[model samples]
Target: MVPEFFTQTNGRGDGEQTLAPDSSFSNLEEAEKALQELAQVFPQPHSFISGIGLDFATNEVSKAAVPPEAPLLNMEAKYRALVEQIPAVVFMAYLDQGIGEAYVSPQIETALGFSQSEWLEDPVRWYQQIHPDDKMRWSVEAAEMFLSGKPLRSSYRVMARDGRVLWFQCEAKMIRRADGSPWFIHGVGFDVTERKALEEAILEISAREQRRIAQDLHDGLGQHLTGIAFMSKVLEEKLSDKSLPEAEEAAKIVKMVNQAIENTRQLARGLHPVAAEPLGLFSALKKWASEVEGLFHIGCSFQCENPFPIHDVNLATHLYRIAQEAVNNAIRHGKSRNIVIGLSGKNGAGLLAIQDDGDGILKKQASQPGVGLSIMNYRADMVGGSLKVQANEGRGITVSCMFPIRSPE
Candidate 1:
């Protein structure tokens, strides 16, 4: 008996398309005829009829099965939907081809007011959108990360399409081919503007409080100590004229009061170096070094090579504090016998570097920095500079801060 035959529409808009049973054709002529019809409908190379079947006895056929294209299309649609739904902007770039962004998630539009198409269309737009002051550092850091194939982690400001300055913390890693050659890069960016604003606010408040306390100590306590020392001197002179045994003791008391007054003045200076403004950074540094050497019995020297003037008092103060902190760390932690503080300026930039000839920072301590190092870094950032603390080649640690100097206008 001949097998049953049935035809099913393949759901394509084309009316002529049909499915046939998975059975042998009745004859070569019938098989040829079926193939010719399929070719006319789905004209391409390498077409196959899987379910179509025929019996030679009766020319009967069975039902056909659906094609593999349906499942693949569904998967692709789902993947795109998932990418678009993510909150953060997911990006992939072809590093080998001039760092072109191959894909940017849909969230970019909502985050930065720029469509994915707009970002992908311009390869240089990303670099161009960086804030002018940050462009050089950002480019250098990015280039280093790309060259070293290291994970890129950076926090920077980007100007969005609508002229909004947004801060983003981005992290990306190099993607490599099977043979270990770099293929591209992929990363995610998160908005950090609000967090940065909060941090800046806190830093400002702290700075204001420190200035107030320093002023109070200098104006209030320092004046009172000076008056006490003067009164004690006058009392010592009166006793000496009387030729009393208490005269010697009074003289000693006068000396002790003078010492206390000097100590109070030193404490006030420690709180905030008021001379930093009038004396300039160079003189303040020299005085500070002298004080450190006298107090700690360590060989501390300040050298300035072509010391350009720093008119901005706040900038000078921050730089002085960073140097002070570094010196203190070298003395207290490193037990340094000799420390060198150098200040130099060249081509609209200033550098303050401190090197200690003592026991170098331990590997563990370097990896896990303490509060002192953190404060130093924060101060460096406030002065528009970067702080680098590294162990010296032979011994000890070196702390360097390089900052920009605005030319007089």
Candidate 2:
């Protein structure tokens, strides 16, 4: 076998070596000549020859990439200096050829809970330290990018070596050799856990407020309004057959009482449902159309159909108010002779449209002289819904609203 040649540097930046052969060198002069030639070419003193091995034939040189002037020590000092000066922890890794088994930075001990030695021993240990819920998703995405030769960008959680859970946003890219094969991967990570917690807290508070308001509308004011409606009916019936000398006066009083009872029923409905069942939002629109027509001596027609159980009390209330307000506006301000209200829920959500044939908006009219439309807009926003109002074509006004049933989480 031919002997193998090895060389490294010693102190003073001078290249030197010790050579061993399977069988003692046949010619001492040739061995000395080969060693001197390698020393002249390298000539670095601080590098050390830590290992030397030889075959019995074919003398060839193969050495570890240990630089002269204490390479490992110099690299450590450079990294430590960087970590101290830079606000973020400094990291470096010796990435294996397969893009696995990277030498994670020593700063991991302070940034995360894991030690650098443990990660170097097993690169997958870092994956194990990731939060269980986010681990699979983040890992799969990272692997896809790495294997497909794309830059790696990801955010995930890590249970630190100190047992603290932290969120980190990481960015990395592959380092490839001249031939286009990946050589190593490098990346940086920083903590984003505090920002994430703050966002969650804000969402929790908003949801709690919405739930409380929904409960109040469904239980508190709704019950009281229902009682008033029943009592009004009782008074109307008792006054219906009265022994009064003025029969016409009695008749007019009874008529007004009946109207009051109807108005009170409408008010109670505005607060909450008396039917306890969904009352199907469209049915509420029809009731408004009838009331408006009778009260203002206008012709009003409504045709609507929809599914029940809207699930959101606030949304249902807002939708009903939008219809009521539109009809009232047509009667009081537009001086409408005829009105048409249409409600549809088949297009995946509730839709309300009201149109009236009347003298449309008076030009430059200030204050509009009605609270109905303003209240309608406010209620719509409270439920996270939308409303649209515009003058109808050729002498009329139209109001329309759409309510989204789903809540964004």
Candidate 3:
């Protein structure tokens, strides 16, 4: 038997109405007649009872189609929530169309002290907010990333809404259209001001310590060794005047003491590079190359083309140390017989390169670099330059550092 139930319209816009049976139907014919009458009254596709026993085919009802906007609304809510919760500012900008930001995360306010609305109001605001000193470098890197469709990773400073300079490490990937054209850039900016400050502090401390050690070696150990060498020479001369065989051995002792003194001086120079400021980078490099050849018995040479002097002693020191490390690696590890150190300036930039003819770097070492290579790379970055070490085609390795020439303020 069909279950007895009553139906009423709730007026909730669902187009649903409930109805109750007027009388019990004994046969299918009577029930069909009643349903036909009810269908006319309702005038809509709906379920109806066919007889005392329900008929599955006749009682089944069709549901209304769900609106298309519901899923979109749900997805938009999820996206907004995700963007707001992220620590970095998430952004998407249209590249094919003019330079316009399509969407930015709510975290923009927390990152740069700028409201989401303010960022969206100005199309060129991103370019305008970069620190003036960093704009050119950032623009070049950004343009290259867009053109190459490569991921971008850069650290730069920006002027926040409150006029405070903040450093950000930005990472982005380019989105391409169906035709392989640049469409959009999706990226995140992480605040790195604290990390940058720490790095600067560490670098300063390292430089100061290096200077102290160099001073100790030059004034303390070097002076004592020089005094010993002089005393030994005097003893050697007195022994020679006495016509004794001991004079030869005393002379040898004097020579060894003098060599120790020279070695101490060389170590001091390598640590602090006092000659970098007085003799300039080119002259200092020439002296270093000659010393390397004399000490190691390797053919080391220095060459320069239109050599211009660098006024910044700190920058010169960093570059010189990088070269020194590269040359030492080539000689000690690569078993190089000959090395060439080259210096040149072009287009307001300086290039320092060291090439050695020896067994090139092994593939494993290149993948997992040692401390010396890492230190050289760190020095290059400290001087606002780039360092690249690669194996030559046939033999040997090349290390190059390129840095821009900035005028004194």
Candidate whose lDDT is highest:
3
Candidate 3 lDDT tens digits, 19-130: 6445666887776666555555543424332222333345533233334574577688888888778888888888766544488888888878888888888888888998
Global lDDT scores for all candidate models: 0.76, 0.61, 0.78
Q: What range of 10 consecutive residues in model 3 has the weakest lDDT sum?
A: 47-56
TM-score of each: 0.68, 0.37, 0.69
**Which is the leading candidate under TM-score?**
3
Write down the lDDT that model 2 would get. Answer: 0.61
Q: Tell me the TM-score of model 3.
A: 0.69
lDDT of 1 by residue, 1-409 (tens): 1122326556776865455554567797876666555545554413354334433234555333334574577687888789778777889888577534399998888888888888889888788887655565566557767788878666667889889988777888888899988898888888778877787677667766767777787788778878887888888888889987888888888788778777776776766674544347788899989989999999999998676777766678889999999999999999999999999876566778999988988888878999999998887665546677777888898999877665444
Clash pairs for candidate 3 = 7-18
| Residue 199, model 3: Cα distance from true site in angstroms | 1.8
Residue 162 displacement in candidate 3 (angstroms): 4.9
Answer with 1 or 2, whichever has the higher TM-score: 1
Instruction: Tell me the lDDT of model 3 at 287.
Output: 91
For model 3, give the RMSD to the true fold: 12.5
